[model samples]
Target chain A: MSDIRFQCIKVEQLDDIHVVRFADDKVMDPARIEQLGGELQRLSDSSESPKVIINFSDVKFFSSAAINKLIVLEKRVRAKGGRMRLTNLRPEVRDLFGFTQLDSLFSIHDQQSDAVVELTTK
Target chain B: MPADADWIWKIDQEIPSRAEVACGLIRDFVEKLEDAGWNEALVFAIHMALEESIMNAIKHGNANDESKLVRIVAGFTASLFQATVTDEGEGFNPADVADPTLDENLEITSGRGVMLIRQFMDDVEYSQGGRKILMRKHRG
Candidate 1:
């Protein structure tokens, strides 16, 4: 586990892949979302070639602002030659990704194990 | 575009340009939709659309100015949902928004709200120089 603590996310290290899970079931609050985004960005910035996997198993709902934050996080990770993936999206949340065409923009997996395998093999 | 009487439930209020207050209003509406027997998927779609619309009004349209207010008018029936959100700020041009789905814009953090609203809602129209947005969804 990483020493960094985040109010909105819980991070666990699996070799080089950091699997992150959100603390809130609803990622709709703007202030919290901003804080969450800041934390994720910091994680990406502080790490060397970070490999991240965001697990959405607990998140029931989120707004576009949250999606915006994820996009920003993705870019930040990629800019540093890191990789980020998402997993365990509920059908509704996955539909939002499809609606925004973001499903194509990010590497998404059905399970954390799958993402771990993909990231580890890459 | 049916008569106002067609709606079984309606809400009209001017709220402060605050995210919490706006989201609270959306939650109330979602609860109402649930009480009215809208299925989970439809409720989720409506909730997402309302969330984006109101947030855009408060964050972008009103610029989070406490003095500015966001006007929301929403009506719903078992089969239909309709809403109009207007903000007290200089309106923007929706057409000028870059397509977030485009390769170059995909990394951009903003500008996806409008597209999501349009995607989830069956019908959406912008007027009053983009200060006001009208959205409608039909339960399927």
Candidate 2:
């Protein structure tokens, strides 16, 4: 029912938890990141759903600008009294987070189903 | 430092310091690296490092001035990948960037591009008075 159109992300909802799938397998610059930031901002402002899940199964390469958008989105969701989790990270993406030590900051799950189950259960 | 590459394709091109142009160049560069036989992870590393360096060249270095230019040069061999990005602006000292691991800078995302580039690439060097950046990654 959402009229919102995101250039880089597909949105779906399960109960109160909103799931977002990144459309591109690789992003080389900030254009997609900026678009994603706008979409995530809209999601945060929506009263329909609070909990969030981000699925990254299709994404492989990204810049820190994308990660910056993620941090901003995380803060926005927290400010809106909800939480977010990341799922389906490729090994390289996982290693990127490990190198940055951001793996300690966000809740990461192995698969989209697992993330949904956990977020919906909690 | 790059070893003697078996086959190297060099790109000496200039962009008008536009973000969209930069993105297109990055994508083309990524495809070129893949065609050079780099595995996914190594290509990803190169892609990440390239984006940071080129973005810095366009954004921070050129101050987003369309009149400025960003130059990119990159090539790869079977085992090694090397790239350089140069900008037309006053360069800043890389040493001035705070350690993102520090408590105060951990949440600040803007400063982490340089750090991430350093983290993913095997060797990263800044020269040309810091307006130019060189990044290399070795494949296993």
Candidate 3:
């Protein structure tokens, strides 16, 4: 129902869950990734027990540095008792997460609607 | 670059340790691979591996010092890709890096770059006390 803008990510609010998507096809730049981390952190901190769903439909490539940012964001969301889910990860990026054994730590969904339903139902 | 050639495009250069320079080099490498008709999966692997290696050299190794230069030598055939990245900064031992996969370290933000390079590249070795990294990938 609402929108928030960041240079690297697009935010859309569907009721209580915020659906976030990358504005760039490739989220590789470290400096830009930092900005993205900051923006996501701010959003997580904006509400009590924020429910966020990160949609990766637009991201084709992202560096390991970008992965680091996501990990940091997850920690921030958790510290605030918020929930975060990642959906629509491209195969390469998804494989990277598996390689690092982070697939167990993060909640990943193959579709955005699944994540939204899960987050909302919970 | 030829599709059937043993080795096609190759380059050796020392560029300033800047993100933009590193990106430009990666862009050129990907373009060469694409021009030679490399598959999307293989291209993605090489692109991800090179991006991590070169960026690590510039950001971590050189500490973003623009005066410092990172040396890169790369060549590829239709089936194989190889590259070496060397930075001027004092290197740390790769063994000392904590495994990010461990539960205790899962929340850590950094230290995943080296692991990614090793995962994507078929052969990866560090020399010059980790200041230099050699990576090779075989096309599938």
DockQ winner between candidates 2 and 3: 3
Tens-digit lDDT track for model 3 on A3-113? 555778788888888889998887877678889888887788777888889999888788888887788888888888889999999898899889999998889999999
Instruction: Give stretches of model 2 more than 4 Å off.
Output: B1-5
TM-score of chain A of 2: 0.91
Candidate 1 C-alpha lDDT tens digits along A1-122 = 35677899888888777888999987888999989989988888768788999999998788888988898888888988999999999898999888778888988898988988888887
Error of 1 at B140 (Å): 1.8
**How many collisions per candidate?**
0, 0, 1
Query: List-wise, what DockQ does each model earn?
Result: 0.74, 0.74, 0.77
So what's the TM-score on candidate 3? 0.93
Residue B16, candidate 1: how far off, in angstroms?
Answer: 1.0
What is candidate 3's local distance difference test score? 0.86
Looking at model 2, the pairs that clash are none
- Provide TM-scores for the models: 0.92, 0.93, 0.93
How would you encode candidate 3's per-residue C-alpha lDDT over B15-69 as one tens digit per residue? 9998977888888888899899988777888999889889889888999999999
Report the error of model 3 at residue B64, Å.
2.1
- What are the per-residue Cα lDDT tens digits for candidate 2 across A1-122? 38777777888978788888888777555766787788888877875447889888888886788888888888788777788999999999988777777777778998989888887777
Give the poorly placed runs of model 3, Cα more than 4 Å off: A1-3, B1-5
